[model samples]
Target: MLEHLGEKLILHVTLGNFSFSFDILTVIMSWVVIAVLVVVALILRRGLGQDIEEKPSRTQAILESLIDLLKGQLMSSFSSDKLARELFPFVSTVFMFVLVSNWLSVIPYCESPTKDLNVTLSLALLVFVMSQLLAVRMRGGIRYLKGFLEPYPFMLPLNIVSEIAKPISHSFRLFGNTFGGAILVTVVSAKFAPVLVPAALNAFYGLFVGAIQAFVFAILTVAYINVAVES
Candidate 1:
């Protein structure tokens, strides 16, 4: 049923003292996403303005708007434009990747990678590890570890739990939203006879919800990074 529903496409490989089972569809979709992003990046790169007085093209203007919006979000998180611009590439790419992947679910034979718990959880873990590493690198290991003991040592356990909860929340938020929407759309289209209603619902589910969730995820990630570094 899982395979039939396109939930997971499994394949296995083994090596010395280790083995792995992976989703082939997710692997393919991830590559597709990366390819799309690369192409967009190239187009944006070519569309960049070269002269101070040159009028910007529509693509350039749209790209500029995207950058500005992302920069604003990052500045809100970091309280510094310099820091936001410095971090924009990583943060903005995360937003774009998730945004594109989530929106792709509307196309036939394409599933949002977020529909798989493994993909979302892995991304969450990446964010978590990056946050902790940034905190440690900025504060030094001793100070970073000591941070949990601050405001009285009794808060240490709670702080530890809070840090661990971040990735869990991040993963589940994206997974639940995307997965539930996919399930609902599937059920509605399968059980009902209406075409227009289902199409509208799918558009809302794919475009609006997908975009909002992507934005939220990116914003939360920036918030986490800022908190980690400042702590």
Candidate 2:
């Protein structure tokens, strides 16, 4: 039953251990996303200036607005503390990457990298490890273990288990939503004839879902960092 369902939804492509399988449209969409981001980065780097007289074009204005928004969100969560300063770059990069990937899937032949279980899982694991390491560093070895004690000693086991589960839930939530959207769009496009209608629908889906997922992911990162860094 699982195999049948997967066969109906996914388009598998294998090349040795390096295999890529997803909705065909999503796979193509992912590439488009990567290309667009690269182009934007290059344009910004070229156009960015030392002199006050150098002015930004429309692309620079858009990029600056996005950066400002992300920075503001990060500041809200962590304030201007040392930890916030340290973590801001990593968190901002993750947000932009996920946002771009999610939005890319709205294009006819593209898919979000967040839709891939491997990608989401890897990101979650990175966050998990980083958080734990920060906690350990801040509190030292024995005190870090003592963090679970909180109000009562009996809750230690449960607290430890909950900490372990956080990454799993974080990764699955992102991957599931993105994959579901990709599958839905693919099915709709296939069932219809001319692709313009489906493309328009995809644009809306990408706009709404992409922004929400990016915000959620960034919020969770800030929360996790706060938990780890605060006593």
Candidate 3:
């Protein structure tokens, strides 16, 4: 069944040592998610009212509610209102992007960007850099390095290893989950060749896997930021 899928619906793009092969439908589906996000951002920025007198539309109200929910989560983690305010945009953007990407995979023939190792790695690296920068900014240069020594001198090496492992784990967790889902769906569709079966699988993908991945991504971001700020 898997072998048959390789011949039927596989999408391939190659450059030098790097090559990507997946279902073309999945690739296009992923991009549609990206496109939708871009459009939503633009629309919200333009349509949101500048003052209380100009009431926001229903769409704007819904967007604001989502942002407020994220804000509340960040606030609970940060403890400092000022810090939460400052960090809100970055955290919010990451949550929305990951949430959308995960949910997009449920669309028939669509592949999630998070399913690609390269894309997930890039996002993890960005978060790693941002976390380090936040740590340095909060504790200063030398203090940031000294942070590893906290609670005991003997634990420094272990702490260092854990820090390095963070990005690797973060990237692979997301990549593996989404990629595995995509592969499972592909194999199932090929084997069953039944319309309703794929739909049921997609419902599970959208309702369960998508929501869990989104929550995990957001919570992890908050946890990492809390570590950086509190260290």
The whole-model lDDT of each prediction reads 0.85, 0.76, 0.77
Q: After TM-score superposition, what is the CA distance of residue 152 in candidate 1 from its true location, in Å?
A: 2.0
lDDT of 2 by residue, 1-231 (tens): 123333424688889888876656444555676688788788886666656677876667777887788778765687447877788788987787788988877654445767777778888889999989988987797998788897689998888888888889888888887777766666776776447766776776677887898778878878886777675
Q: Write the per-residue lDDT of candidate 3 for residues 47-128, one digit (tens) a residue.
A: 6877878878877897788788887765568867787888788877777778888877666545576776766777788888
Q: Global lDDT for candidate 2?
A: 0.76
**Residue pairs that clash (backbone atoms under 3 angstroms), model 3:** 25-109, 26-109, 26-110, 26-111
Candidate 3: which stretches are off by over 4 Å? 4-31
TM-scores for all predictions: 0.90, 0.79, 0.83
Q: Give the per-residue Cα lDDT of candidate 1 at 26.
A: 83
Q: How many clashes show up per model?
A: 0, 8, 4
RMSD values, in order shown: 2.2, 4.3, 3.7
User: In candidate 1, how many clashes are counted?
Assistant: 0
Model 3: how far residue 189 lies from native, Å: 1.9
Checking candidate 1 for backbone clashes, the offending pairs are: none
The parts of candidate 2 lying over 4 Å away from their true place are: 1-35, 52-63, 192-197
Model 1: per-residue Cα lDDT over 31-113, one tens digit each: 89999999998998889899969999988998899788887664567754665777778888888889988998988779888
Candidate 3 has its poorest 10 consecutive residues by lDDT at: 1-10
